[model samples]
Target chain A: MDKLIEAIARSGNPSVVGLDPTPALIPSQLMPTPGKDQNTAGTQPAHVDDGDDADRARSLADAYLRFNRAVMEGVQGIVPAVKPQIAMYEALGQEGVRAYIRSCALAQEMGFSVIGDIKRGDIGSTASAYASHLSGVPGGRGSSPWHEDAITVNPYLGSDGITPFAQAAEASDTDLFVLVRTSNPSSGEIQELKTEDGRAVYECVADLVSEWGRESIGEHGYSRLGAVVGATHPQAGRSLRARMPHTFFLIPGYGAQGGSAQDVAAMFDDHASGALVNSSRGIIGAWRTSEGYSPDMSVEEACDTVSQCARAAAISMRDTLLAALDAR
Target chain B: MDKLIEAIARSGNPSVVGLDPTPALIPSQLMPTPGKDQNTAGTQPAHVDDGDDADRARSLADAYLRFNRAVMEGVQGIVPAVKPQIAMYEALGQEGVRAYIRSCALAQEMGFSVIGDIKRGDIGSTASAYASHLSGVPGGRGSSPWHEDAITVNPYLGSDGITPFAQAAEASDTDLFVLVRTSNPSSGEIQELKTEDGRAVYECVADLVSEWGRESIGEHGYSRLGAVVGATHPQAGRSLRARMPHTFFLIPGYGAQGGSAQDVAAMFDDHASGALVNSSRGIIGAWRTSEGYSPDMSVEEACDTVSQCARAAAISMRDTLLAALDAR
Candidate 1:
C-alpha cells in the first residue's frame, strides 16, 4: 500500500484510470472478425457456433480484451494504478471473465497496480474462497490467475465476512477497500441512516475499517485496508477522512458519475497521499463523445484516435486532481 | 416464486441442495486428465500450458462441473431447487466460470429451479448488467448462456442497486433473494444494531424487501423477490417471516453450518411453503467422510456411491425438515 502511495506521489497524481471496457467503446477493428478462428491463444472452449449467442459473446469479449490492452498501453506512465470494474466484463459470460483476467494481467505486466472492482461479499468459507481467489493463498498450490494489488469488497455481511479478506490481504501483502459511503443516488437509503449511537451507517463502517487496518499500517501512516468513499458526497468524504486518518480511500463516482475534482479533494491528506480517485467512462469512452473524435473515422484511425484520447484524458484528470489537492 | 412454492408442496419439502463443489470433494475419476483435450466441447481458450497454474485450474474446474452435474442428478427429485454458489466455481478462473454456467443449465434442464448464489450488488448500470447476465434481457439477442431461474444479491448499495434486480425479475418472471439476516456468527455486528427510529437494521431491510416484492407477487401469493434470512438465527428468522409474509425466504446455514431443521422451521408457512433451506457440504460431500464409502472404490463405483448418498441425504433432510415444520 505504501508502494501504491509512493507510486501516486512519483506520478504526482492520486487518480486511477478505471479500465471498464464496454463493446460500444471498443473500436470495430479490435472486435474479433467473424469466421476467423476464435480459438487463437487462450483457454476458449471449443463449442461450435453459427453466428448466434456464443459467437457474438465471444467476439464481444475479444474486443473488450483488446480495448483494455490498448487503454493500459496508452495510459501506462501517467496513471499509477488501474481499477477494472468486473461487472462490465462479466455481462458477456465466461469469455468475458477470461478477458477480465487477461486485462488485469496485462496491467500488472505494465508496471501498474490493478484494483479488481468486484465488490464481492459472502460469509465464512465462501468469503475465504473469494479472498484467496483475488489474493493468492499462502503456501497454496499454483499462482492465482486473477491476482490484484487490491480488490473492492462489500461490507454487508459484517466482520466475519470481512475478516477473511483482511487476513488474506495481510498474508499476501496486498490491500482491500471496503465499501463505506457509496456514490450512487440511493446509497443514502441505507448508508445515511442514523444509528442509535448518533452515527450514520457509513460512519460505523468507516470506524471498523480504521480498526481493521490498524495492524497493517504502512510506512506512510496509511493501512493496506482502505475505504470506498464516494467523491459524490464531498461532505461525508471530508468527515470520513478526519475519522479514518490511517485508512486510505478509493474515491469513485468521479467525472461522468458527476463527481468533480473539487468535490473529491477532501478525501486526501495534507500531502495528497491518502486517496486514489477513479474515472472510468470519462477517460476510456472519451473518444466516442469528445469534440475532435468523429464516427466517420476508419477502424484503424479510430483505434489510434481512441488511444490518444485516453492518454490525453488521463493527463487532464491527473492535472485537475493535482490542482484541486494543491488548492486544498 | 409461486412455482417454487408449488414445487415445495409437490416434493413435500422446503429444501434446496447447495451445489458448492470443491476439488477435495470431487472423486479422482471425474477430474479432467492432464493430456486429454479440454477444449473438446465448450468455448475454452487455446492457451497452451505445461500443466502449471492454468492447467491445474482447468482440471479442477472440470472436476467441479462433473461433481455438480452428478449432485444435481442425484438429488433431482427430492430437492425443490439447487443453489450453486458462484464463488466456488469462480476460484478456478474462466474455466471455472464456464463450469458454473453449465452446472446451472444442467440443473435447470433436470427440472429444478437454479438459484445462482452470486450475491452480486452494484449501483445503477452495473447492477442492471448483473441482473441481465443472470436473467437474460427481454427479447434481446440469443439466449443468455448463464441464465438462472433466480439469483442471490447483496443489498449493501441500497434501493438503486436492488431496483434493477426487481425490474429484471418482474420482466423475466424469475425471482431474487436479497441478503437480510445472514447465517454467519458475526452478522449481528451491523444487522442487529438499533437505528435512530428504534428499528434494527435488518428490520428496516425487511420492510424494504417486502415493499420491493409487492409488485411482483406470483400466483401462489408469494413475491418473486425474497430475502436470505439465515437459518442459524432462528428467532430473527421467525420475526422476519412474520414481518415479510408475502416475501419468500431462501434460508441458508443448515447441517454443516450448525442450523438444525428445528432452527430453520420458523421460516416456513403453515403448509411448509414460502421458504427453501440450503444444505451444501452436508449432502454433496457426504460420501467423502460418511461410513461405507471407501477410497478403494473405482471412479465409476465412487460416482455411483456419491450420487446415492446425495439422494439419501436429501431424503433424510426432507423428512427432518417436514417433522420440524409439523412440530412448529
Candidate 2:
C-alpha cells in the first residue's frame, strides 16, 4: 500500500483502473463471432460454440482473462493499482472464477499491485478465513489466483469482522480498505443514520477506521488499514479525510459514477498519496463513446484510450490538490 | 427453504449434516500428501510434505468432502438439509474451494436442500452482489458451482446489507439464515453489547430476523428468513426461539461444541419442523474415537455408522420435544 502511495506520487496521478469485465463489453473478435449454431451444454445463447457447458464457460472465462490482461497492460505506468471487481468473473461460474485468478496473476506478473475489490465481511473465525484467502499466508488455506496487496472490505459485522483483517494485515504486511461511505444511491439509507454523538453512521465508521489504523502505520507514514469513501460526496470526502488522516482511501464513483477531477481533488493528501480514485467504465470503455471512435476499435486500442483519459484526470486532480496545499 | 421444512416434518427429524472439510483430516491414500514438494515457479521448500501440515490439511478437507457426499447420499431419505462450513474448505485453496462447490452440487442433486454456512455480510450493493453470487439471480454475477436454497448470513451491516438479501429471496423464493448468537467462544465481544434500548445486541439481531421474516411467511406457516442460534447456548436459544416463532432455526455446535439434544429441544417449533440441529465431527468422524469403531473400518462402514448415529440423535431429540409438549 505504501508503494501504491509512492507510485501515485511519482506518476503524478492518483487514479486506479477497475477491472470490471462485463460480457457485453467484450469485443466480438475475442468472442465466438464466427458462428452461432454450434451446440453443447454450456454454449451461450448469443453465440453457440463447440463444447459442453463447462467447456463453453471455460472459453468465455478465457476471453475475460485475456480482456482484463489487455486492460492491465494498457493501463500500466498510468494508474496506481488495478481494482478487480470479483463479482463479474464469478457470475460466469467456475470457469469465470478461474479466469479471474488468471487475470490477477497476469496483473501481478506485470508489476501492478492488485486490490481485490471483494467487499467481503463475516463473523470472527469466518472473517479470518477471508483474510487468509486475501493475504496468502503460509498456513492459511485456499487458492486465490492473486494474493492482493490490498482488498476492499465490508465492515458490516462491526468490530468482529474488522479485527481479523487488521490482524492479518499486521502479520502479513498486507492492506485492507473498509467500506465507510459507498457510492450507491441507497447508501444514505443506513450510512446517514444519526448516532448518539451527532455523527452520521458513516462518520462513526470513519472514527472506527481511524482507531483501527493506529498500529498498522507503514514506512510511508500511512496505515495499511484504509477506508473506501465514495467520491460522490465531495464535502463528505473532505470530512472523512479529516477524520482518517493517516488512513489510505479508495475512492470509487470517479468517472462512470459522475465524479470529476476537481470533485476528487480534495481527497488526496499533500503527496497525492492518501487517495486512489477509481474509474471502472470510465477507464475501461472510454473509447466506445469518444467522438469519432468506433466500436470497431480493437480492444487494445479502446483500453489504451481509457488509460489515457484516466491518466489525464488523475494528473489534473493531483495538480489541483498540490496547488491548494501550496496556497494554504 | 419451505420444501426443506416440509422434508423435516415428513422425516420427523431436524438433523443437518455439516460439511466442514479440514484438509488435515483426510485419509492418507489421497494424492498431494502434505509436506510433499509442491515447489512451484522454481521455488523449492524442503518441508512441503513432511509435517502434519500438508497431510492433515489434505486428508481433513478430502475426508470432509467425501464424508459429506456420503451423508448426502445416505440421508436423502431422512434428513432435510446439509450445511457446508466455508472456512473448512477455504483452507484448502483452489482445489478445496472446488471440492466445497462439488459437495454442494452433490447435496442438491441428491434432493437435499443446501444451507451454505458462509455467514457473508457487506454493505448494500456488495451485499446484493453476494446474494446474487449465492442465490444465482439474473443480474448478480459470479461463478459458483453450487447455489444453495438458503445461505447463512452475517447482518452487522444493519438494514442496508440485509434488505438486498430480503428482496432477492422474495424474488427467488429462497431463504436466508442470519447469525443471531454464533456458536464461537469469542462471540460475546460484539453480540453481547447493550444497545441504548437496553436489549443485548443478540436480541436486537433476533428481533431484526423476526421482522425480516414477517414478510416472507409461506403457506406452511414458516418464514423464508431464519436465525442461527448456537445450540451451545441453550438459554439464549430458548429466548431467541420465543422471539422468532415463525422463523426457522439452524443450530450448530450441537455435538463437538458440547450442546446436547435436550439443551436445544426448545428451539424447535411444532413437530420438529422449524429447527435443524447440525453436527459435523461428532457424526462424520465418530468411528475415530468411539468404542465400537476404529480406523480399520471400511469407509462405507464408517460412513453408515456415523449417519445412523446422526439419525438416532435427531429422532431422540424429536421424541423428547414431543414428550415435553405433551407434558405441558
Cα RMSD for candidates in order: 5.8, 5.3
Per-residue CA lDDT of candidate 1, range B55-151, in tens? 7677777778778877877888888899999888877777778889988878877889889999999988889778766544212242556758889
Q: What TM value does model 1 have?
A: 0.92
TM-score of chain A of each: 0.91, 0.84
TM-score of chain B of 2: 0.82
What does candidate 2's lDDT look like per residue over A220-287, in tens digits? 88888899988888889988877888988898987667676666778777655688888777666654
Error of 2 at B11 (Å): 2.1
Interface RMSD of each: 7.1, 6.6
TM-score of chain B of each: 0.91, 0.82
Q: Candidate 1: where is the Cα deviation over 4 Å?
A: A27-51, A137-142, B28-51, B137-142
DockQ of each: 0.35, 0.24
Question: Which one wins on TM-score?
Answer: 1
